[model samples]
Target: MSGFIMLKHIKHLNLQYFIKNLPQLSHIMFMEPSYSLQIYHKYSYEYKNGNSNCDDRTHKNLQNYKFKCNSNQKNKEEFNYPSISEETLLALAEYFESFEEHCDSNYDVTYSDGVLTINLPQKQGIYVINKQAPNRQIWLSSPISGPKRYDLVNGIKWVYASDGVSMHELLNKEIPTFISSKKKDIDFTILPFGGKS
Candidate 1:
């Protein structure tokens, strides 16, 4: 069978699995048929040369795949982070500073250089929240949830990349529980800039 026919057959048989497992394959197959044919020919040659481990070969090829990115583009499409303004940074800093007053004597909360460090004696660990200016994201190193990057969405909320949990919501849920205090409602509405209130 021709490589094109074989690919069509594979798609027909397991379209969902093909899309899920080999997303790049679907892209090449649909967007660049000639490239897909080249890939097929290369793999066929490799298979005929005694490289029978298809999984290993596929993984290796994927690792070597050169994803194209335009250097002239002002904003790269791969990253979802938006541009954060200076006023927004100050507002966020102010918001984090408020946590210091609410924290118990045992817990040490400090805000400096757009970074918020929370030392929880009861938890026996530190939580670090910092603004990554280049990425326009807020990174959180949490004792409970490991590391998470949050992007500013809707010009106001810093939302987690994976779970879409807002920074205010995450802190309100986590910090109060960590310090054994009642859940405090954090106000994210008071942005310094004319951002979405």
Candidate 2:
């Protein structure tokens, strides 16, 4: 298939997957057929002796030798981690790797003359962050604004979503209810009590 065709196929598959799994996708754009065909020729012919490289004896031997060594090492480690499933351990390792990447991607917090700013990508519109710690309190505000204060943390369980809900629902209402339901110790004031005598 031409590069243009391949790109279209890839894009189509991606769109289809998103449509089926995620109900939140607003739209999916497809690559133009003309653009796909032009790129196909460029990718297919640019490689040097592609099939011959695979057939090389030295390369074949090296690949097989490396594969056997890797297989044996993996087998040995399987027994070593008998207490923990290999899949779970692998997942934990993958999670940490992605966590490190997330930390790297987050903006640096800067403070200057009573103003605190967190520089982030401009593509994100009207950025709002609600952070909370188990020890202290829930923080609500734009990270670009000022110093973060942590009083007695409001028992919250907010979720960042594209759904149209008022900030009251986003912060005050739904979160505490969710937390209260989840943990019995988390006593949530779902509805404010009357202050009347």
Candidate 3:
């Protein structure tokens, strides 16, 4: 009866909500040791099964995941990996530029050199996309999920090193949703690739 219960592995947001509502819960009989224990067990199960009531929009805000790196680097001489060609880089820049023009004015997009930045309104955060010439990768810093690195495969697609999600697919899924509104339906497909329409 003197020991304590440690809630391990609870997500940060869930923990915050629990702590915030503890006083209210206590007022409603949760202060009783047995009731508290029952509540804790119920929530613990929910957390483990990914059924927590936390809002989906804010779930990815926690930057706790580790980024994956290339494992094929075996020697210092081999460190200099092949990067995307100038032509491909130009195409990507053009693509981003087109996206900027089509997206709602609420967002501020900029592309310079090999970097493309999408600055969202306050509270939404920013996304940074750039080419890692030395690593032969395309790197993304997502406001929602933190940093991810992508490598080109088959001379056509840039794929995330950890999950194999293509850059084209990720942007197509994320960007439109971020800027969606009643009047605007942004199409990420407008991004030009190697002169293709």
Highest-TM-score candidate: 1
What does the lDDT come to for candidate 3? 0.50
Residue-by-residue lDDT tens digits, candidate 3, 1-197: 01222223222335436644443333222112233444455555565577766543323322111000111122212433343444445555555555554455666767777887777644377888887876666688987778987655434555554454666677667766565354265444344332123
TM-score ranking from best to worst? Answer: 1, 3, 2
lDDT, model 1, position 56: 55
* Alpha-carbon RMSD of each model: 11.1, 22.5, 16.5
Clash statistics: count for each candidate: 0, 4, 0
Q: Determine the C-alpha RMSD for candidate 3 after optimal superposition of all C-alphas.
A: 16.5
Q: Which lDDT values do the candidates have, in the order given?
A: 0.53, 0.28, 0.50
Give a tens-digit lDDT track for model 1, residues 1-197.
22223334443433223323454343223223344445545544554575555565554544343222121122222334433544555565566556665565666767777777778755568888787866566788988778987655444566664454666666656655555344356545445422236
lDDT at 66 for candidate 1? 23
Question: lDDT-based ranking, best first?
Answer: 1, 3, 2
State the weakest 10-residue window (summed lDDT) of model 3. 63-72
**Over the stretch 161-184, how does candidate 2's per-residue lDDT look in tens digits?**
222222233333432222223333
